[model samples]
Target: MAKEGDGADSIVAATITDDAPTKAISSQGMESINATATAMTKAKNAIVVVEEACTSSKKPEEPKNPKTQVLIVPLRWMSLGMTRAKQQLVLLLAMRLRTVKTQMMTSKLQEVKAEADEKLKSISGENVLLQINCKALKNENAKLFKGYDDLEAKYTSMKALVKEKIKAAKSQAEAFKIELEATKGTNAESISKVAELLKSPPGFFKKQVKEYTTMVSTHILLVAKYLYPRIELEAIGEGYADGTSEEQALKLINDINGVATSIFNESLDL
Candidate 1:
């Protein structure tokens, strides 16, 4: 029984020994698991650090401006050149307009000057016409006065002749009365009667002959006076008158009528 009890105690001790080695092996396994866990955590922390470094390394980019996209922008000097070109064109057109306006003014002034010159010339022509008319009248007056003197001389000579003739006739008046008395006493044979009648003077014979001759002279003088003036007027018209334009023709007709009336009045006194 002691040997059995010792064997039992040894078995228990061996089991405890085996159990201690298992427990030690189990603890080593736990330590290996812990170490693996620590390694995995380090690796995870290193990956997180690298990811953070990569995120930190990237910087936010500045926004691009749409205005900055042009490869070449126009310079201020180029725009100034364009403006200058436009201004030059405007100045050129303005100068042309001014030149045209100046020409128009000059042309208008020339037209006015020409019209004034023409009017002046016409007025001068009218003055010349007046001077010529005065000269013509002056010439006609001299001719008319000369004609009047000649007519007066002729009238005086004719009057003297008539007076001499009347004086001579008065001397024969008694003889004529005697002859008429002789004719009344004749014994009337047909041939003797005829002879007496033929020899006798008619009562009004001398005075009637004188009156007929005087009437012829007066009528001839009147015709001459009017003919002289009419010929003078016709000569003047043919040589110097303007054409038979309406205005001038009317004026001429009126002037001629007035002159004729004046001549008639003067002739009445003559």
Candidate 2:
């Protein structure tokens, strides 16, 4: 019985020794769980810091509304329309100014044309007057030329009659001289008859010469008074038509008068 009791005590002592090791393993497992929890907390704090830094560095987005966007489009269109209206007003004023300038130019052109027409009318009137005067002068010249031709014909007839009278008187004087020589110392009556005959012929010749001289002088004076002035007036008209100076035309007329005066004086002397 003493040996059986000693074995039972040894068995119980071994069992207590196994139970102490199990309690020590359990305490080590609890310490490992606490360290893993602390590491997880540190990782979570680092992720939160990264998220805040990224949000601060990025640009913020502006808020947008549908009503504000639609209102901006209409305001921009109104501004564009006002600008176009101002440009159109400036263009209209420029066009009006151009129209006024064109009207003024047209009026000035019409005035100039009116003045030119008046000048042309005046020139036509002057030309008509000149034509009328020229025709009258031509008629007067024709009448004077006819008168001069008639006077020339009469003067030729008078010269022929004076020549016949001179021939008859010379023949009678010769015949009386021959008769007186033939009847000499014959009779006083015969001699007295011859002497009377000679005196008669000489007296008739003297009377004829005086009458012819007086007629020639009167004719010449008539031509000078009536024909010469008309001829000088015609010459002045011609000079004016030929564009001669007034002084030169006057000098030519004076020269013609001087020649006519000299011809008249010579005829009187004859």
Superposition TM-score, candidate 1 onto the true structure: 0.27
Q: Each candidate: how many clashes?
A: 0, 0
**Residue 86 CA displacement from its true place in model 1, Å:** 10
The TM-scores of all predictions, comma-separated, are 0.27, 0.33
Whole-model Cα lDDT per candidate?
Answer: 0.51, 0.50
The residue-by-residue lDDT of candidate 2 on 103-189, one tens digit each, is 657988889989988998998898899899899889998899999999999989988988889988889988988986675434445
lDDT of 1 by residue, 1-270 (tens): 112223323422433444333433345445643453344333433323322322342422332433221211222212333333322222222234345456767999999999999999999999999999999999999999999999999999999999999988987897888886776433335447866764575757656655654564455456666778555544543655556665565455455656555655554556
lDDT for 57 in candidate 2 is: 30
The collision pairs in model 2 are none
